[model samples]
Target: MARVGRYDSRTIDKIYTHVTKKMDDNILDLLDNL
Candidate 1:
């Protein structure tokens, strides 16, 4: 159970990081367009 929980958390962290990185890129693109 502990191992599964740890793996799930790691996956969530990776997904979060990826989403945030994409958001940052979008924001940069918007700024460039302005």
Candidate 2:
């Protein structure tokens, strides 16, 4: 496998996806708690 380079779109996309999922999960939990 190739090593990831800086500013790679794929890496950025992966980070964005992980963060979005975390945010979505948190929001759902908050709504459930309310």
Candidate 3:
């Protein structure tokens, strides 16, 4: 397997965590409105 520069696992995990956190916050807001 070839190392593809700076696009590593840690960066991917950070992005995934950030995205999931945003989604969770949105869901909570929607639920609160109901």
Candidate 4:
């Protein structure tokens, strides 16, 4: 059970990182457009 919980948290961290990176890209694109 502990292993499963650790795996889940790791997965969530990866997803969070991906989402933040995408957001940063979008912000940069918007700034370039202006």
Model 2: number of backbone collisions = 0
Which run of 10 residues does model 3 get worst, by summed lDDT?
1-10
For residues 1-34, write the lDDT of model 3, one tens digit per residue: 1365677888878888999999999999999999
Best by TM-score: 3
Candidate 1 per-residue lDDT over residues 1-34, each given as its tens digit: 3655657776888888999999999999999999
How does each model score on TM-score?
A: 0.74, 0.78, 0.80, 0.72
Query: Positional deviation of 20 in candidate 4, in angstroms?
Result: 0.5
Per-candidate clashes, comma-separated: 0, 0, 0, 0
State the lDDT of candidate 4 residue by residue for 1-34, as single tens digits.
Answer: 3655647776888888999999999999999999
State the lDDT of candidate 2 residue by residue for 1-34, as single tens digits. 1455666777788899999999999999999999
Model 3 TM-score is 0.80
Q: The CA-based lDDT of model 3 is what? A: 0.87
Each model's C-alpha lDDT?
0.87, 0.86, 0.87, 0.86
Q: Please give the lDDT score at residue 13 for candidate 4.
A: 82
The clash tally of candidate 1 reads 0
Q: For candidate 2, give the lDDT.
A: 0.86
Ranking by TM-score: 3, 2, 1, 4
What residue pairs clash in candidate 4, if any at all? none
